[model samples]
Target: MSALSESRNPGATRSLQVVATAGHVDHGKSALILRLTGMDPDRLAEEKRRGLTIDLGFAWTALPSGQEIGFVDVPGHERFVRNMLAGVGPVRLVLFVVAADEGWKPQSEEHLQIVDVLGAHGAVVALTKRDLVDEPAIQARTLEVRGRLEDTRLAGSAIVACSASTGEGMEQLIGALDHMVGNAPRPDSTGRPRLFVDRVFTIKGAGTVVTGTLTGGPIAVGQEAEVLPPGHRARIRGLQTHKRSLEVAQPVSRVAVNLTGLPTSELERGDVLGLPGQWRGTSVFEAWVRPVRGLDHPLTHRGAYKLYAGSAERDARIRFHGASELRTGERAFARITVSRPVVLDLGDSFVLREAGRQQTVAGGEVLDTDPPARPGPDPAARLRARIGLDRATLACRTVIDRGAIRTPEIAVLAGVTPEEVAAHGAVRLEGWLVAPDVLQGAAGELSAALRAYHSKHPLRPGFEVSEARVLLGQHHRVLSDPGLAEAVLGSLAASGAIVREGAVVRLPEHRASTTGREDADRLVAAVEGGEPTPPTVRELVAAGFGPELIRAVCADGRLVRISQEIVIGPTMLARAEHLVRAHGAPPGLTVSGFREALGTSRKYALPILEFFDASGLTRRQGDVRLLRAR
Candidate 1:
């Protein structure tokens, strides 16, 4: 099947977004949403009777501009903060509800802090239950809420008054929500999809279905995906966004996927749905964090806490730099060594709460999701952080200078999106980062070596391509990247750096010469004048010829070494070559014919013919020899 048809949905290709509610308990978050959306968020009858949200609830509303916005109504009770955080990461704009009657409560302050640390772009503050208070009281509460929001991302926000019972300012709240949706930035959908599965169940005929906000990328029907942490691969048999079947669901949309190949009993709410092998469990990462204000005890180094990011939660230990006790309201560079790996990206906001009490302690943005250096106060760690802040060009240069870097390593060091890294030519994605020039340089060196080899041994064929690769120490795959390596070799060949001879390579313009040229000439003259059987190396050396001269002539194929004592020049091979050419088989010329032709004795004739047979130039057939075909 085609990749798209097998993996993507044909109908669900639209952008769906998430908006969440933030406020103190009993601040009228659910009621205000009920007034604006006309859908009751608090589904449980007990919750409705108690006049408080005890669990997370989902609601949908259409803005005045006709844009659909989903709301995650989280419990504001301090005890249920975990549930509140579980729904926060996927929200785009926050509906920060503050009661005009109550002003700012503890839960109100904490919820605002959560939104601020989450780096929410925009917010519409719903001043709920305005009818319960007079005008002066409303003004006083607005000022108080404003004061509490100072020095936060949500400091400058639109506050609209509304009453769930009478609907005093529902229209203004809807308009503000519409404005927020219009101005909110869209989430990136280029990376692997990470769906934080908050709910899972089996619907009789639907098999197993899991639902959550799609935080990262698009997911379609028939896609082969995985549930992370446990790493189970499953086919997306179906997908639904806001209860409607879709071909592709975009980022920030609430999606329910019917998955095949996994039993409903094996999946859990905390597990993430992602592309297979796209994310791994990580135990350590560096973060920039600020402590909560007015804490009785300082944040100790190696202090354990509950870490929440995206859909994954883990118990992590915080290791602070230079201070054992982290003071309240203090910002510092800290490392959170998690107990397990969760899908996270650079700049992803995370909240850290005290492990046992589950109280919010600190929160920060993810600077490096897959840091290489160990988390500590060391020079290498500092260097890594500095590199993490560099621009793409500079970062690419740094990695190239270092020789090789993996994709995850580059993502962490550059603090850039992995998609950006993949898109940029800054690094070659051949399982590692290598300087494009280095690969080119190695190829050039190999070609140069080949040309030099050919020039020195002009009569012999060039060296094999395999030998050149060994000298270059580059893999065959590296040589296959288009003109990456080949272009370099071509340049070297053009510049007389190397010579290409069939499958062999050699050096250009190289020749083998001897210091004792005269002595070598005399030996050649005497050998040619006498029988074709050449003299031994000892005899040639004794006859006023040095060993170096003999070795050089032998290396150039001018003299062929049959044994330690036996040697023959190109003249003897020429006769053998001629014999093979004349009679397709050398055995046609018997031992007596070979001896008579070379004017050599029986003793020399047998050894010469036998040497030719052993060297594959000729083959022996019983008592005679046959020439081998070229």
Candidate 2:
């Protein structure tokens, strides 16, 4: 409930959008923003004295469509990029400034990388200081700037040459912005929001104020919210959107929240405020990472770097997966163990920096914000593979980046239902749901693993069913799911690609029927040619057959081993079974009675009776036993 909506009579809803500025130092970004918004973006005395933007500034204006637009004016210097990201990260549209007098420069390239890495929709290029350069020079600079933007998300954006002093070509810039606001998605009205704290300060009247872009859902006045990372609880004493007091602040709007129960000094620029259970602070997570172009060297495992996410910057240690070293041009799955607690969302885009070099090395999209504990297949293997946004319009992209998701978390992640996710090609497997591509890739990896294992050890019965799950996990993470792996292997078995024999899984062509002509004949003679009872395994070993070979033959299903010292042919066991069924007493089938009835001594009789019980063929009670129900 916005203050207007909660008023005596609410009128038709109106939309307000935000945009940020980015460019090289001295590119006249501040000049352009001031010309359009009628406010000086350089508020700090140091910035005014040095004629350089050392911090972020805010201003706003109305477009021709009567849409109120806010501008987050960011610093153009490379040293202040963390501050620039704090501004641009919360806005979708950008006013990319390039001074015609100086042309493109270094910070321009770095700022543009941040734009692409953060996943902004589109930007409008502003060729500033056109008054200082000639018409041909302006045209030449425009061509150069567009060429630099090639292969980028904003390559196709509209560019207009303008002079803030003369106000030339201002209307064209307004037209481009109007088109963006019309096409930009609307904010979600759901009452769950996470405000990334960018600016925190104190006013005499209001105890403490924190401001950022309100995303995920809506926040109402008097709503209880908690500061994350530290999880300090607070109450929303007041709310302001675009600097006006509002009872409720909607998603995607620039919001300033009056908070109680915490001092302004305790709250910093990187803290997050949200309702309980909607978000949590985490120190470790995983993402699908891609190194940016032109890196001097490879990104190796366990390398520490500076991570810039939303408005927060923290030192992070990277552990590359799929490979120990990530090639510069390749994308790989990696885990990041940060030194600080940060609120992360699935599919959030972030920029990582080599702090010593002051250069951005790689950027990635998060795959799992809340990962399940990966207790490795072998507890000792220590599989260290510990493997945000937005309101309504921002919500859909969040869910897609999240990969495998649960049904209940959909509403909080994307402001939609499970049905909506399924309609978009997500599939349900076991207890979780994942995108179609996840299932496809997992199936392929698991199938390939089975082929590899069979090729290496064809003589083995097959891979143990449990070991198969672990082997697949060692390669691709998504296939380690027990239920899904069971389902996949079971499906493959039904399709004849593999065979399942109790606890073991093997290729369909694998068999346990016989070892060979030599071993089979010897085993048959030993059991059938013997009188009354078969030779024990020790006697067979003494006769020249190795223990392993004899055991393999016994396991070949031609004979049954009742105990370490007892072995019997399957035919003889059937005769003994028939005798027990015909004469073994229901009144009391004692061990002594079975030994005499089967014409075998007590040594073989008790072990055979125990084998029958172990196989569920009979039951033992007190000093007697009886047939078990089938």
Candidate 3:
């Protein structure tokens, strides 16, 4: 009977999970898996002759608990660390193998570090070769391994001593697997499937077959897919999960795809097959880097490094921002300029290896998938907000940050064209698409600032355009840019949350003060209420009120402004509209004809007539003005 049967069911069918084995060369990771599942992970003849795993080996078994588990047996030699990384990238658990006789090893530490960087957090530390070591030695070695894991993602991992030769503690290891598998996270169904090709080979009659751990979403048989970077289209002719034929393979599970489109020679390691339209490979991206564990040195700026993300490894350079060098144990922002295009999602974890060093210097996650060549200053701070915000909110914040971003930049943020962004409920001003919520947030900001200003100076009616820009910039850096701030203000005005008059902005509730209000009332009284010609700004300013107050009255909708000087109150505007309606026809009233009809100077009447034409209330033909349908 398979040793897997020695483990008992927890009473129900359990979760499916993948776990990788990592340790030093010839430390019995393969033998241990062989003992546990009765299947040899080492499939290569070269590895069989050399007695070492030269490549990743796959095996699986069903525990008595009915939990189906897959194992990716990774080569433990330092030379195959990249191969090891590919196996460990998508696994939910790491079965960290530390031989009891061999004790702690360097390659084991490297494997754990890669696991941490890729965020495959949970681990089970196996003290293998227990039969070769006495109890005291086994306990000491187990404690040493535990000490190595302190303050890490695997800090709380269960440690079990097991020997493939004598089977000592094998059941305990399987029991631990049963207990932990239930807590492993299921695959994300974000509707975008990604299978980073780790192995590519041809099958008897199945054509080209590629295998990797599936993630992000599901890949079903007969699904249309594309190989990224190369961007060759394909159709999934067949699907296999854990060696069993499947109609659809879910994420976090190992999958082998039979594809039709490109030949087997065209595929290679590090190629990604995904749902085509949702993603594109980019050569440049931004990442927020943090130093590796126990690395007590700063990272050099503009240094070339080897970066491993998913199943792809590429040559990359770090362009550190705000610092010449990144100090050890400190977080820094940097742009990852890759030699090859890679399909990366925002927040995907990656490991960075120094060019000439044996140790990995740092690791980070992609912060921006397609960042501008020069990300604006304080990019890390801006990116952090986006991590928690929805795409539209981030797009809006991007506009706020840099005043305005162009269509291409908007495409980077919104994942669509600026026109598409607007079509999907976002607001567009000029050429910039604004987050619908941003408009409200900006209005609230303007309203709040105006409210504060009113509280400080009750006599002031509103914020002058220049003053409003200052206050907006003070409220949010994005608001400080005149173009974007005006866009926000313009949106607010359109929504009627604030009033925009001449060169001033204010909340709808704000009004000119006690003296200014009474004087504006008296100025309107002096204008003939039923006449076409009205009092001018010069007359109002000479009477008592200032030009500023008169402008404020016009902005607050108390008066109709005809020109710089010619103005009329709402009562007189009603009489002038009455005269236009009295001649409302196809060949309406001409400027001179209206002037003669109103018995007024052309200076006042002409501006009023022009205002009517411009307002869409009347359409003029040569010298005639026709009233538009109400």
TM-score of each candidate structure, all chains considered together = 0.67, 0.64, 0.66
Q: Which residue pairs come into collision in candidate 2?
A: 188-392, 216-390, 216-391
Q: Which structure among the candidates has the greatest lDDT?
A: 3
Candidate 3 regions with alpha-carbon error over 4 angstroms: 1-15, 386-433, 436-630
Q: Which stretches of candidate 2 lie over 4 Å from their true place?
A: 1-14, 185-191, 375-630
How many steric clashes does model 2 contain? 3
Better of 1 and 3 by lDDT: 3
Q: TM-score of predicted model 1?
A: 0.67
Global Cα lDDT for candidate 1: 0.71
Across 35-101, the per-residue lDDT of candidate 2 in tens digits comes to 9989898989999999999899888888898888888899999899889978876667788999999
The sequence of per-residue lDDT tens digits that candidate 3 reaches over residues 515-545 is 7667766766666463555667787678776
lDDT of 2: 0.74
Ranked candidates (lDDT, high to low): 3, 2, 1
Candidate 2: residue 300 Cα off by (Å) = 2.4
On a 0 to 100 scale, what is the lDDT of residue 422 in model 2?
A: 65
When summed lDDT is taken over every stretch of 10 residues in candidate 2, the lowest stretch is 379-388
Writing each residue's lDDT as its tens digit, candidate 1 over 1-630 gives 012213444654767668889999988888777777777888789888888787778878667687888888889999888888888766758999888888888898788877887788889899999999999898888888788778888887888878888978888888888888888887765456878887777877668888788876777777899887788899998887666676777888788888988998888766889876666656677677777654667777757788888756788888665556677778777667888777666566888888876678778876555554534346235534544443555455545444445556664444445455435444454345555666556656675665666545443556776666566555433444443344445554666667666666666554334535556677667655554655667877787767666665677666776666677777776775576446535336688877777676776667777777787877777766777767
